[model samples]
Target: MKAMTFKAFAVVNEIDLNKIAIHCGIPKKFTWEEPLILKGAILESILGREINAGQMVLIFSFGSVVFINQTEPSETTILLKFIQRFEPDVEINNADRYTDDYKLHIHENESLELADEYVMVPEFEEFYPELISTVLAKSVALEKTEEQLGKIHDRLETMIDRLEKGKLRIGNKELARTTAKILRHEYNTLAYIMILDKPEITWSSSTASEFYDKMMEFFELSDRYKILKSKTEILYNIMDGFSTISHSIRGLFVEWVIVLLILFEIVLTLLQIAGLLP
Candidate 1:
């Protein structure tokens, strides 16, 4: 009998769950006797267990239900070609985005994809070589954009600093940061998973809503700060210009006084020469 197996993983780096299963990574050598493959979340919840790092879970079944399907007609065919372009550490092993019901097995190898680092795009006009400073702000809306990213940076720094340094673990799907960070690239919007020290892998979509909501509020506050700062800068620039103009005018008046004094002395000398006035 040909049985298909699906492999997946999650991290309990900081989850506050009771470890239902002990250090045994995989339950069985193969799970084919029951012929029923249960969902990972359900299995996890039912068992009241937390999956740790470097753990493997194997789910076996007769056929397979796969997610992460290729959108294009030839996506499957070209998958290999595309995969070759990226490093194994950067590869994503999935048939689709998400699945609740499926037959699957999971191995907790240090897959390059799980612990991969994502890059942050900075929003600065000076950084853009093609655009001048004056036009860059208008084109990129830099103040608005920077405020958004600035809030993210600030929030992350604050969370990391305020919270005890540890891994984030989860028992419920409701606190998943799956949508905000993984799919959406909104890293600062991850929900509160119990924090513990461990190699963390957060792939749950459970915290997306909460994360997004928090981030939206953060963005609004940042926008307001940016507006206030812009106005302050403008006011300061105007004051500086006024001071410079005042100094220049003062110097011009002094020069005019000196010229008039020279003219007056010349007139006195001419009057003395003509003997018409004292």
Candidate 2:
């Protein structure tokens, strides 16, 4: 028997899910309310040809459109090519699995474990799409954070150079302001990924929830999530340090100005008392 291959693709940054539902001719019975999950029928081409080797499930969410194919590698390529024709604007990222080498034992809860590399499920739901989208979103967010961090590092270096030259500069305040803006942007990005992009699965089905939790472990989604969270915290700490340094410098400059003004006043009074001026 040929092994089953599972392939998932994140086809877009955001999709008008209503448009997808109408385009796919989704049935009322197959739609979910909370997170707006829709499942389409087995997709066929214009010539009435099946899109993939076995079956294709079309899933749509707010920021992601996923096509799960149960097929071989060659057929998978054909399926992706067909999708790209209609979705020219999407940015695609994929996760793949091949289940040939392992002994498969079908469980009652619609999930089958094939060794350590692959897991098979009878149906695709909100969990699968959410998992795939979270992975892609985290990757994109991580890249953005790294890029911002590089800019922050460069600015810190420039500030250190000016200080070494004994120049009391206010540019650090501007740098702090810019860093605050970047920090807000990064915070929003991470928040959207963590909170808004969550999967809203109904808890009415214990089996479904169990399967999802198990699959999450199998995919190591928690590990990736933790890593991203840690990086965001580090970025926050650096920005906080910059803010502290900026305030400290500003305070010292103000104190020096006050001292210089007092000294000037004392000198003027001494000069007048000594009759050195008219």
Candidate 3:
């Protein structure tokens, strides 16, 4: 009847793992396969709390943190502050967040199964925490990206409404800003977060792979990512259409000015020949 609470936050765009490792005096090479684990004395010191038993903090390079068994809000807040030293841009009060409670029953006569946020296992495994934390961190990161795309979608919708009213009032500066925002979002999702990629451990351990797959499906990560991509393409097309229309309008205005200038020149020549103007 042992249980733990996992709270994950997507706080920043990216974390400089190398800098944090060096400052923390960690010698081992930090990689995407694993997160920086903090527990025991280090965790207590960072938290400034005496009772941090069974509590663990997992910091991923992709700007998410999973606090295992650290259910207290104050504890979570304090640890985030500590992380801010390494990642100054980390957003502490992010809107996209995740929390789940899991019950682990070990040494039981039941089969190993994870269902409805409960785990029944014959024996406790060491990699359980890592596996769980990885999924939680990734899920939270996707949640943050989803929120960003949602905002972009709303902005596009507003533009569409204006277009419906025959109001294409976007200037060059506004167009450039919108294009840059969309491209930056795509790049961040692909480069820093790499949300579509699975954890490296999954390639080696079949059990880990299966668990990761199930968790990903539960979170609808793949489907949501595809939707985001589709929305991005639609945005691109809309911008292209806007640019084309603007160019056409400018060209038509130039043609009309050229015609008017020619007509004025002909009228002046007629007046001069008839001795009506110099």
Candidate 4:
């Protein structure tokens, strides 16, 4: 499961006061419904604690002991206000949690009872994995795209150097073409972001299509290969034309110099014969 952290607020509701009073040393005056901000030392206590994205954080803290069920990490208003005192950098955005994201969990249960898996029912059996895999693939595709782009950039630079040094050559035009075609396959992967806006993505399934769309916004920043291919071609064409023009100009200049020298020799010999020079 993807893991990410976000601010959360929680408040126990309808506490059994008598039970808490007998077992706990703290004052039992506060009912279970009392709102407590989940911030400050408590937040720092659970920092880097992994929780499932979009799940609720079940904090079971009493006395000095904290037990956390980080599987479904969400928060009530109390937890949000509590964490505010610690002054986290980001505010409470009610952000969407895509696959592979986490939320922090804090409680005073003392014992380490980490929830490795999620609390899932039969309803989510199919939709969950498919959606998760889709986003995960997109994330992977994004990383791969960046790496390929770097290689492409290096190739372009090398091609430019070859052009400048009079060694313009395509090492394997067919190979490059094949790779470029594969990169085009990434367009389908990249288009996953737009699948939310388009109906085709959901036509075959259900769920309003929220999670993937959320991460896609961030993914868009890293998505440049689509545009790069077209632009690289244009740049190659430009360099090719420039090289041809330069070669033609160099030939013309050499021809002009030769003609001028020949004319000068003819005139010099004629003048000598005519006694115009000593």
Candidate 2 lDDT by residue in tens digits, 1-278: 23333334444433344544455565443232222332233355421454544344434332333334443455445544444555555543342321112112234566455245455655554454444433333444434444555676676567667767875454665766766755654553454335323344526566656765665565555665566557667756765665676678889989999999999999999999999966
- Span of 10 residues, lowest total lDDT, candidate 3: 95-104
Model 1 agreement with the true structure over 1-278: per-residue lDDT tens digits:
11122222121111111121222233534322211222345434433454332222222121111212112323322322222232232123432221222121223442211111111122212111111111211212223233444554454454445334542222123123321322222211111210111111112333333332333243343454355446444434533443454466667879999999999999999999999887
Model 1 TM-score is 0.23
Highest-TM-score candidate? 3
Candidate-wise lDDT, in order: 0.29, 0.49, 0.75, 0.39
Query: Which ten-residue region of model 2 has the weakest summed lDDT?
Result: 95-104
TM-score (all chains, Cα) for each model: 0.23, 0.56, 0.85, 0.33
Model 4 agreement with the true structure over 1-278: per-residue lDDT tens digits = 23323222212111233433343243445432221222333343344443333432322111111112233333333343333333342133531221233232333433322232222222323333333333333343344444545565566566567668986444445335534644553443244222233223445644525433444444453345356446556545644554565567677879999999999999999999999987
lDDT of 2 at 8: 43
- lDDT of candidate 3 over 159-190, digit per residue (tens): 77988999866678877878888897787665
Q: Stretches of candidate 4 above 4 Å error?
A: 1-125, 165-201, 204-206, 221-278
Q: In lDDT terms, how accurate is model 3?
A: 0.75
Write down the TM-score for model 4. 0.33
Best by lDDT: 3
Please rank every candidate by TM-score, starting with the best.
Answer: 3, 2, 4, 1
RMSD of every prediction: 24.6, 7.1, 2.8, 19.2
